[model samples]
Target chain A: MLSFYICLRKIPPMTEPRINPNVSVDCVIFSFEDDGLEVLLIERNAGQNRIEDDLLALPGNLIYEDETLDAAANRVLRELTGLKNIYLEQVYTFGDPARINKQKDQDWLHSIRAHPEARVITVAYTSLVKKSNFKISPSSFARQAMWVKVKEVPQLAFDHNALLEKALEYLKHKIYIEPLGYELLPERFTLAQLQKLYEAILDDHFDKRNFRRKVLRTSFIIPLNEKQKGVAHKPAGLYRFDKSKFHKI
Target chain B: MLSFYICLRKIPPMTEPRINPNVSVDCVIFSFEDDGLEVLLIERNAGQNRIEDDLLALPGNLIYEDETLDAAANRVLRELTGLKNIYLEQVYTFGDPARINKQKDQDWLHSIRAHPEARVITVAYTSLVKKSNFKISPSSFARQAMWVKVKEVPQLAFDHNALLEKALEYLKHKIYIEPLGYELLPERFTLAQLQKLYEAILDDHFDKRNFRRKVLRTSFIIPLNEKQKGVAHKPAGLYRFDKSKFHKI
Candidate 1:
């Protein structure tokens, strides 16, 4: 019952079982914005052509037979956002026997000229970067590239929902170990921004005093001489992260 | 120039570039033993007359066209150790182009009738198990299954040395968050044994008094009435981990 069938725009057809349609890469790109922590997803128009056509899916592509997994992830990211030097960390692998056997999935694959019964094993990856760092443009296979707040994600195409959950869990664990909250902030940000980043990712709140005290003890969160500007209320002092001092909280 | 090749005795030969040799799984099984912190490795006699013969490698196999990555890891672990229901955490993916193209690697894959130019992407996993809980037996692909001290590991086959390094680095980070050191100790162990386990994995010394005080503060470390018997020196008390309290280190 293990079968994998995948077809998307800009991706060359992987109809030949001999070409390893069994392997692919899925990305859960995370970025912080004014709304909150969001994930990048692509929309596909499901017309008479495919059953799952109109659903949203994570931007992904089959790993080329000659390329490494990291390369495949970078390619997909590059193709979708035109971003280079994107770093992807492995999160998990989704290889359920019927991952691609859903009726809608079958229809989509069949409509796209892929072997609908193919079993695909995909390596999922996670990337956290400042959303402003790159401009995103949808690739050919997708009708639109959208940044959806993690809390508001609807049912995704294929097994991307599960992939996204696992990536978020990994990121939650990672933030406490490494002072990576800075990646989600502006070049010079207020302490409140850093705390909010943690709250947004962990989905919880920390007492202001306790949070400030803990962050100050880390040494890496350096207070800048500058403060927030053009604000109606009292502005908070801005801070920057010193990469060299990154260690245990 | 970027071709990839890999070979192991118990592993089935994957020659057809059309068969999708692009995906694989590798397991790094860790357990505490009398010698120290050890990792399970399988010895492959590549051939009776081959340069790479007798090299040790982490137990691994290609992701089958029909199975999930977790199932594949479980199969490899079961084949070598006869244990089922083993849990594996995804570590990382090693997709460096040079992963399987070393001179010794080229010769071994060539000797084994495998296409030395095929690229393979392997998802790596790490599992920490209580050594005494399972019975280990070498499978057909491996001449012998051995548990060597992590520190004493020699140059391994494929890019396993790099794989091992990443697994170790991950475990080090996880230990600070999870009180998993107990998995490597005897059911009823003394404080000394616990301290030694931490020292072995972290590769650093801990002040005995501080270590004892810190461990005692954790609610999960339950003190038992049991103590070591018939030792030359004073026997210390035993303790066990309380799984229910394993949250928020």
Candidate 2:
């Protein structure tokens, strides 16, 4: 494997270098669908001429000389997908030297002008956004970017598969502490939808009675006067996520 | 303030650099004292034969080219304290660009030969260790390192004051999710001592009745058949932190 930085540095005229400068930012952008969770994956250089064209990866870029790691993560997501104003936070740093040592990974990096064997330490960030909130776009480095089902994703470019796994692991824990489950559901949602979202992400069935009892204790998941309709089954009561009560919960 | 790397890249020959590497690891080592939460503070290199003899800072260093950020953090802690096999985990990264702009911060960096004006993006890690389990030592960069009460700590070098606060904030949440409270207590501890530890760190009282009830729910805090003796007050029943039950909790 080669080394690379998951940075968002605005590379000035000095375009190519022999060794990797190392630090970069990589984003694992996640969204929820009716059936399961989804993550945004960027096709490896879709616009560029292809050698081994069957690769996909998380949206990432090298950190520039002056930009904050946070800024770099936001820029990478924005540039790759035209996504803006979404919730994103730094999750962890992936700094193993052997991360880019795979043959296909090396070939891909050579084509992109990154040192195939240089040590790259990526600052990985996880973002959960409403899929409808942003549109996808291609980059000079990535051919095309799209959101795919988390379970259905194929081998991603570089160490991104591991990155994706880590991101989800982080999300599972984050949703429990914060109200991330709300992000996956509609603005006005039924209690069933919220429970299903939790069950799906956690890969376990949450008892309906116990779930409601525990959730109500949080003081943030608010009940709205509205209710769900147009379903084959009878309509269910609706609820809204109260942002102001977040900290207190 | 002057920018620096939180790394330990055994500098081979290239001694001085004009620019900052941007990414490094900083360790905020914490231990529990009998009365309060204590944090490790390293006095700035007074042996450099220069100014600012009373300044204190966290134990941090720039990352070496080949080591992972995790390894760098551990090595920094080990090199400075001679401590090993202690609990350590990533807390957060402090990356505000203006962090190094203060005059005192910059002077200290110049004396150490790090980039005086470059931006340093630091990955901060927090470690909780038994003070008795390890002995404190100094590195080339620190004059002496010692544990200071978290509340009594004055202004620290660079952004370390902010770093220490963040570590404690992280600790508050971590103790609940995991059995970190046990690290601060003896093998067998009284309910009053346990409540005091919680109160001291959160700076708020946990009602005695509510605390005992709530703590009983956590499988990790086990009731011991022993009691505290030779105390000024009543000898309270003792409890133990069960490591085996950590995952279950």
Model 1, range B1-249, lDDT digits (tens) per residue? 223333345467766433336666889999986557899898764556535444788988666666667888888777765666888888887776568787776676666535556777678899888878877787656667888889899998889988899899888888887877656776677778888888877778999999999989988888998877888998878888877887874
Q: If scored against the real structure, what TM-score would every candidate get?
A: 0.84, 0.84
The reply for model 1, stretches above 4 Å from the true place, is A1-20, A45-53, A113-116, A244-249, B1-20, B46-53, B81-85, B110-117, B244-249
**How much does each candidate deviate from the true structure in C-alpha RMSD?**
9.9, 8.8
- In order, candidate lDDTs are 0.78, 0.77
> What range of 10 consecutive residues in model 2 chain B has the weakest lDDT sum?
B1-10
User: Model 2, range B129-162, lDDT digits (tens) per residue?
Assistant: 7687778877777778899998899988788898
Output per-candidate TM-scores for chain A, rounded to 2 decimals. Answer: 0.86, 0.86
Clashing pairs in 1: A3-A118, A3-A119, A4-A118, A4-A119, A4-A120, A9-A141, A18-B18, A46-A53, A46-A54, B10-B141
Task: Write down the DockQ of candidate 2.
Answer: 0.39
Docking class of 1: acceptable
